[model samples]
Target chain A: MDIGYAFLMCSMLGILASIAFSIAYLMGSDTRKIVKKANFAISTFTLLSFFTLLYYFLVRDFSVRYVFLYSDTHLPLVYTISAVWAGREGSLLLWLLYISIFIVLSTRRLDKLDKVTAFANIIMCTVAAFFNFLLLTSSNPFVRLGFHPPEGYGLNPLLRTPEMAIHPPAIFLGYAGMTVPFAFAIAATYYREEWVKRARNYLLVAWAFLGFGILLGAWWAYKTLGWGGYWGWDPVENSSLLPWLTASALLHGVIVEERKRGMKLLNYALAVVTFDLVILATFITRSGIISSVHAFARNKEAYAYMVLIVLSLLLGLVVYIKRKDFFEYDHSYRLRERLIQGSVLIFALSTVTVLVGTLTPLLMHASVTRGFYRHIEIPLGTALVVLLGVCVIAYRESMLRKSVLHSLVAGTLAGIVCFVLTKLSLASLGVGIFVFSLVGVIQGYSSRKIDLRRAGAIAAHLGLILLFIGVMGSWMYESSYTNINMGVGQSVHAGDYTLKLNGFREVNGNAKFDVVAYVSVYRDGKLVGVMHPKLIIYNLMRSDRIVASVDIISLPLEDIYIAMGGVTPQGVASFEFYVVPLVSFVWIGSLLIIAGGILAALQRREEKARKGVVDAEGEG
Target chain B: MKKLSILVGVVVIVFGIALAMSFKSELCPYVTVSYVVSKGEVRNVQVNGTIVPNSTKILPNNTLMFNLSDGKTEMRVIYHGILSHYQEGIPAVVVGSYYDGVFHAKEVLLKCPSKYKVAEENYSTSKVLSKG
Candidate 1:
């Protein structure tokens, strides 16, 4: 028997045992110790199996089919590690490994095995078992080749970047972390009223990971795809966004549920839908049902994923319908509460639009144009930004007039500055909303006594405003100069920037050869720097594939992006140049959003500690 | 609160109707070359086909013209953008309108050939190396 296969089998058995034991505990058996042991056993077996697969990649074991497909003798150590998850089988193993890790974290403190914890553990174990069954049956990473080849195929040149190494892991972490809140919700339907509070923190952490993962993917596309655009709304991309949108809605809806114990159905449904969307995303990406650039080749795993989706949805609906009394609550909503609820509705609407657009090709046999998404998103996003400003400012009703006055002034000043810089007439509205949100955040800080949760919310809202501003600037007024043929030492002017092609050089690396163009960029006759846009020819298993590598000269306000379209042996090159403005704010704003989410999660812990201290004092 | 909820509901309803109208207008049917030809001229549609080998040409002013085939019928496609990954014998999905017997594509989406495939045995080992 293969060692990795044996380890995986043990892990699968361990999960089955854990699931059975958890069910036993839930059925009034004193099986806490047994369930904990089973959970720890599965985690160990899963860790061993994951490392075993990684070990095969590192050792260049061509006898293993997966290693033979995605690894090579000349592949670097870091990429060799990354190749462990580059394919369908390896990535599924990576996801299962994350599930096991989260399982250990959830079940480790089983001494106080309450009903909610027991139910959550059971749900987690059941999810783990499903993935384990997938690995053992259809998509096993440990299948041995009939014979060992001399050299293995290398990883795709596109995925040979640093970002790809972390992107899949971050996304899988987010996907797996969602199971916790989902488990909590399912358990809470029959059990605890305060489960939303605990589930909110987990959701925050997962939402932060999902958001950061998406931005990383977008950044990778901008830097590598050579399209000069960050987002294309591809089906695979929309699949990920679907879950993030639902998670965002759930995060907001939990605030209402945690405070007033109302909107329970909204919170529960969002949690369930978020988890189901994650599975749906996986199915869409892996099943090849959708024709996306990022989709895996058509496989049988999609059927299993569809089954999982239906089962989970049925489970969620059944559990939700059983608890009719949790939906009954009467509470008067404040203005701030109304604004937050409005934000949640906006997120839900966005999710629905993107979902419909993504599925239209499959269902209606029609492709939704980019115009469809932009038409919906622009107005919805702007309204959400405005609500963010109003929500923060509505903290004090007495200062509403003064806040409006300040916001108007700030917005006008920002609009004037933007007009002077870009000389564009249509940017005033976007800048006004951005500045209004900024003023609201500033006032939000000034009026509060340093509450971390509020501070985090303000930071997140400001980050979103900046991101919106970046999108507006880059998309609306982007300038492109295509098919500019230039020779050595020849200069061309493109929208206030001059590019002089210095020369082209060829260099041979370990596994690839590069044709690099050295072009000096100048603004107003002053030399800025030389940017090298290259064409990389990677020697793969049977052919040499040519890939264009774009070079970007990022200024504070804009990025001078260039791609060597086709360079001839005589040194004449056709280049594509683009001036993408305010794109840097997208990165900066996304990072701040992730940071704010994490800070909010941390604030929950601090608040819990303070409450615990107060309760202890009262007992004393 | 009730009044505000009603106002929000009205806004969402109006927005949804507008959105549905825009979506209906923007949706382009995914069709084939034979379908487009059988139906005469199409205003907007998406067609997936393989690029005929040696039929791709760079026209004047960098407009790309190619012959696209869906195994049954072939059609002419004209595009005005830079497709860095464009190659012969590769599958591509082009979004455009078919008129005057030519598919004027607004965008071209190329499918990378080396995504995920089983390594074929007895493969040609000859390297087709390009200078630049």
Candidate 2:
């Protein structure tokens, strides 16, 4: 039998085995042994299916329709591997593969086998089966071609970068990781005792992966797209951001629920919303219901996916309504509690704003500008930052009126100082508030015993402060569009530097061609370095095959960027130069945020272990 | 705490609605050349149409002039920036205003048609053979 047929057969068998396991679990049988054996088999089959597709690409098998469409013989080995998830069918298959891996890993982490675990398993398996059915019917990556062409179409030239290769898989890992939390949220409705604790680690893992994936995507857009700006508030980008906002809120809500037994329904709602938004994001990107740069072609599979999303939402609502009485809590008047509540509310508001903006194009056929997002996010973000400062001080000092006043005075004074130093106008006030919060949180942690969770939260808040400062500084001070038409030996002065066009060279490759511009930079009449900005053209693609290569000179305070537009017939090369201040801090702050997440996860694991030991000691 | 929560909720909703209304004018509506011609000089709108092949010209003041069409009606567009290398017959989104029989475009975005659709014909084989 052919490899494609073999792969399809494997998926079909995996689905059958999963359904059998689900049935066995529902029948109150001993499901531990069945789950263990079935997980291994299902994982193996999924891995084989993925590798079978990869082998076809590696061997330049044009008889495979997917390979013929996305890969050419001239593609490098690295890109050939990257081509695995470059298209709609292949990406869905990749999603299936990642979901399968997550399922095996999560089931292995189950400490005991009970109805809760079994039900969670059943839920996950049902999701897996749904994906398998879609793969079998609508988006099979293993379909074959009756006739083979001599050469296959190459991958899109815009996606030829190294970052694009890893972007999709990282994002899919994030989307698949969210399923674990959704499963636990459903199980929480049944078993109320340990579900929150059980779901904590899974939720954190998903949040961290999603955050990291978004950072990578932003980086990819910066490096690959010649737009000079990282984010465009595009519909696809908004789709990703929607889930991220809800997931962040869920993270905060989980903490509140664990500490005070409040916001339980809120936490559950967030969990369901985050997962549903992930599905909605996939639908937006796949269904062609809204036009986006990232969407695939319109397909019939969208209707099936929409049906699944609506059913999941309705089911979650039913469960939540049925279990409403279990989640009631006493009202608390504590300042710290109020701050947490307010922050969650703010996050929800921002989520609604972005959701409305994103769906407007599809629902009303109207486009929301980047300014709308900015207007909503700026004031709310500033308030959230100020609230963080207040919360840290209040939490440390028992929420006293005097303590609150002290923190406010300190924050305002710091804001004025920042205003004088940075001269960032109104944004400097936000920077000041963030700095005060960072300092207060650090002080609060330092005075007490060094607790890992507390320290991680502080670090994460500090990272957010830095991110705000970076964003404010860069957005307010960026100067660009100093377009200069220069030939060899012609110099143009922009900002504090003089750019001289040194020369140009043509680079010919197997699949594409590049025109590299050699430009020398001088500051105060002293030579700094030569910058090479190129224009790359792929000969295969029919439209938008040309990409500008940006050269950047990094400094502590600012980055000097240059992009070559094109060379005229008269040997005059036009270039666009920009001086973007404090942009590196944005990237550095994101790394800190990711690091803090890792630290938080590790500390949570430690806390769980220590609690387990303490409980055992108490019993003894 | 109940009263406080209610107050905060009201403030957030009021603020959100107000901000959204204030910025409603900034939203750019996507239109076609036919719509622009029928509407007669709308401001701050977006136009999506295909560029007429061989109709692009570089003006002396670094502005680009091109004829855009929606397969039925055509309009002249003037963009005050360097035009990127674009496919001749594919759709491009121009964001600006229609004024005085010309579309004053502030931004021009080329659509990558080949990214979404399959290749119409296999020219790769012949190109590779020729190169070899």
Candidate 3:
């Protein structure tokens, strides 16, 4: 066995030991010391194995089969590092690393631990061991090639971007981090009320990372896919959205459970479902059961993930069945609380819709189009925005008149803006609701003395509104001018902008040969920028593959997006230009949401410990 | 409370019906060129086929014209979009329909075959063919 394989074996052994010790601790044994040591050992061995694999990539060890498959001598240092997770086996290792790290973090402060924590530790250890088992059995990265080649097959040319390098790990971190909440949910069902408080931060971090990961994926798609749109409702994309929607709902539902001791069972169910969706996402992306642009491969490893999903759901159902009293709806909510419940309900329904759309292909051999999602989700999203506005306004005592007046004013202003920006359509009403909610958030924030959680909520709400506006403007008002064949120094009018093709040149680099076409974007007869859209030919073993790189100029109102289709032999170039409006808001809004999530996750320990007392005397 | 529950039930039923309708309307089957040819005049279908070698050319109107085959049947395809990942003999899923003896493709999806469980023998062969 090689060094990497040896390290992974040790890691697997440590995981198995930790599982045994944690279970023994759960079964009235004083193996706490052993459990902790085993946990630490698992972390250390996994880290060592991970680094050893990275070492293989860095040294360009073609003798290692994974390195031989994904890395080459000519790859940059950063990409060489990313090449560690560029394949199925290495990414599974990355998942193991995250699981080990989270396992240590979640079980760090436990002594005289309750049965719940012990149970949680056991579940977490078992999960880590399960993934390790997968690595050892099916998707091991340490297989040897027996003979070192002169060079290796390079990483996919599309995945050589900074965003692509970071996307998979961010997504895997989100997937791995979700186990803490799920384990806590199952453990808390064993008789504890502390899971809501304990699992909240883990849930928040996973939800935030998942959101940011989806954003990065969208951004990368817009940049590299040469398509004018970001989210294409691809099955894999829908899989990621499935967990995000449920987790978002669960995030809100836990607040209810923590505060009012209501929706406890629902919160547990959400946690379980979110975790299941994470596995489902993995299965869809890897199984090739349904075709997606991000297909990994159909493999036995995917079947293992599918079994894990079923077992997780079964475990959740058993716990839920055992704890029937937790399902009692004990408290009548206030108007604001009810609105939040409505919003959560909408999120849950949207999750169901997306799940059906995603799985329909596997069931019926027919895929649902983007129209299917938009037709249902847009109205649901609009209702959510309206509920958000009303929910914010309902925080005050005299809300009816103030809310009506505020919503009217925000709606009128947003209507006018939408009318001027694009054509006034039914979507303007949705934009108006977004603006209403945004204004309500601003007003509520300015009027009240708030804590970090409240401020973070407001920031996140504002960010969502901005993101909604961005989605509405970009998807609805987007226009493209394709088949714009131009010679050098030729200018053509494309909507509100003029695209002047200046020249073409070729450059041969060590990794890629680029044929870049320079085009000057002008608005109102003034030069905005010289954008160079390139046709990149990545130098690969035995062949070269040509891909188009998009050049975008982010104007104040619209982005001038250009991609060169091809350059003819006569020096004439064909181009596709897109005017995408308010696309920057998607990015800026995503950053705000992430920052808000992080801010909320980093709440003071005292604040988190402050539990909301249930007033039994209140009306039910 | 009972009346509210009834109202919610009605609203849910109505919404579910609408969702089912939209889903039915939006269902696009993934098929092959032979299936499309057999069906004849199929609409809103995704056809998977291999790009015929040396069959790709830019038409006079700047649209891309190529021949797509599924080993048995080959059909002409007219695509308006830019497909930077197109390679001869590589598998592609084209979303559109077959009508008037030609497939008018709205979108073409091509993913890297190296990532697949299936061996990339076709990809290597296409590379060799391109070189030749």
Candidate 4:
């Protein structure tokens, strides 16, 4: 009679209904009526299940085991809702809900192609069924407690930030978005070219979301984790990067298959790899086979995930073997084609390297350091930048000797300027190549008639150049770890600024306490605003958890970051200061990259519409 | 097109060599405290263990010294840097070398324990107490 039981019953009904619908679709039944109605019903029930869980958290219903574990009376309303996906069971439900909505939207779009839509629905529903089973068996959020507790244990102190509310959902959306493309890839194995075209827009949307999600995670780590650096090449982070890399390769490979009818098999394989990697990422974070900061507690759901992955791989292998000859293309290769091929190859190689590095710990029982990753990534990244420069010059045309010469000169000149500015040797060379690519793309865009598709590619390439420059400047030439102890009115010099401890204030919140430090900064004897860095301690069920807050003064060229250490018995506060150069450009470049991806998706939609009109005219 | 392929092949080979060389210099393989104790005073090696509770001390020069234990063996670690907020009895990884029976740590990374570990323990204990 409880809400939890009702929610569980609804979810169980959804699973059974979807399974029946999938069976009907796979049997070549006229699934038009069944598909539409079942998709609507399943999506509605999943939403209701999610909302029911949310209702429990909102009402402080500690009788439900999940609500008791993650929420308390003192927790804020926003985080109360966010805590719905903060743990294992609730996050799986969120994943199921997103996939159900995707199935409804995608099935609606492919209404004209009934057979292909039916096949795609079978694929989507099977995925949905797997998650539903996991939720039902191992990770059911609807489980209840016999005894009612007066107060609930609160959310993890580390996950109590504003970014925690957005980060998980963005990542889950990225993971769910890939399912549409995977379904189309399965359809492509049978229907080939037509399905590939249909899958392109979905692939772009997924790639864009994944990239945006990654940037948001990096921002969260940089701001909340109190680490001066953004990326640590953690196992969980690398798991997400694996899919993004393969998806990037697929994004380019599909273009080749679209224009030249080549790389068809590669595109299909990339799609499969992207989806498998998404599931693999989930497994890696949940299984606890590897140590990661983002992992949930070790659970039995890992076995379920592994079984799903193995079955998917076997199915993909069978399909690839059955239709081996369908991927053959007879067109002679061209320069532009070769450039695209090179980029895809580089992406594939990078993904392999990261995958090996990330899994090495589990296989060999030895962990590779972040330094090992940088060794492979930096040189490979620099070469990719150089290749992008060549590709921009060779866009829509064969490579010309004169253009090559021009690019070389531009690169060298830019490199020299960068060397003079930053005084770092190899990174200057990287900047030089980036600037050369930027110039080439700009020239190409301006010389041609306005084409949004090509413009989107150019914008993305430009964004990469900016991102490379920012990373090089910050990583190669930054001052850090300058610890200074100062009392009120005592000044310490760091980089080009003077930091003076002004005062401190204590903040007592409902669930936590904070000691906020007021530090004044001056540049060239000009006063800047006061920076408030805090040390926070949260009241949990058993003990208090401490977290440091970073205060950052961001500008176009650099950031002045300060983290409060603590106060000594002598009344001097300890602070760590870092002057990171050109880091803002990284965020700016990320925005540009996201914008370019969205622009490209819009252009694809327009192109598809135009093609539909032309086909109709020809039929007439 | 063949020439372009050849050009890419050459670039990949060159980058591969550079990557391999960089890997050699950047390799920081983690060793256990027992391994470090057996092989004394090795340079640029990492060790992973747990920080012994209440064994931490701050020196006059602002350096921190603590005992790092791996259940069976314990070693002293000296770190000279800004110490972040870290809990006692948690897992930690120290990046440095062993010298004169102590770990001269260049950096110390503290790992967060599973939040549910305590809850699980409490639940089991309460159940046992009720049965008794």
| Each model's chain A TM-score | 0.95, 0.93, 0.94, 0.93
- Writing each residue's lDDT as its tens digit, candidate 2 over A1-620 gives 66655765676576567667756876867667767667667777878888888999999888889998888888899999999988877777777787777777777754565667677777777777777788777787877798887777778766777877887787777787788888878876856544677667777777777777778777777665545566667777778778878888888887778788888888888888888898887767555566743242355676777777887788788877877787888766466777787788878988888887887766654576778888877777777777776766666445446655656677788888878886766766765676677766655555666677666677777777777777776676788864578988899898788999988777889877777889999999998789999877676644445667788888898877888766665577788887878888888877777677777778877987999999999999
TM-score of chain B of each: 0.78, 0.74, 0.80, 0.72
Ranking by lDDT: 1, 3, 4, 2
Scored against the native two-chain complex, candidate 4 gets a DockQ of: 0.21
In model 3, residue pairs whose N, Cα or C atoms come closer than 3 Å (at least 3 residues apart or on different chains), thus clashing, are none
| lDDT, candidate 3, A447-554, per-residue tens | 778777776787788888878878877888899897688989999999988889888777779987777788998889988899999877667773335567899888
Select the stronger candidate by lDDT from 1 and 4.
Answer: 1
Docking class of 4: incorrect
Where's the lowest-lDDT run of ten residues in candidate 1 chain A?
A: A291-300
Per-residue alpha-carbon lDDT of candidate 1 for residues A1-620, written as tens digits (9 for 90 to 100): 77888999899889888888888888899899988888889989988999999999988999999999888888889999999988878878878888888888866776657778888888888888888888898988899889999898778777778987888888888888899889888887867455776577778888999898899889888877676888988887889899999998888888777777778888888988999998888667655566643243356676678788888889888887777776787867776677788899999999989998988866777778888999999889888888887778887888877997898789889888878886777787788889988888788668678777876776787789889889888988789898687888999999898999988777889887787889999998998889999877766764425667899988998888998766543556778999998999888888888888998888978988999999999999
| CA shift of A23, model 1, Å | 2.1
lDDT of 3: 0.79
Clashing pairs in 2: none
What TM-score goes with each of the models?
0.94, 0.92, 0.92, 0.91
Off by over 4 Å in 4: A1-16, A22-28, A292-298, A396-399, A542-544, A607-620, B1-31, B41-46, B86-90, B111-132
Please tell me which predicted candidate would have the highest DockQ against the true structure: 1
Q: Kindly report which residue stretches of model 3 are placed more than 4 angstroms away from their true locations once superposed.
A: A287-289, A292-298, A416-423, A542-544, A606-620, B54-58, B81-88, B110-132
lDDT of each: 0.82, 0.75, 0.79, 0.76
Please write out the lDDT profile of model 3 over residues B18-54, one tens digit for every residue: 7999898988888889988887799998887888999
- Model 1 spans > 4 angstroms off: A292-298, A420-423, A542-544, A608-620, B111-132
What are the iRMS values of all candidates?
A: 6.7, 7.3, 6.8, 9.8
Selected candidate, larger TM-score, 1 vs 4: 1
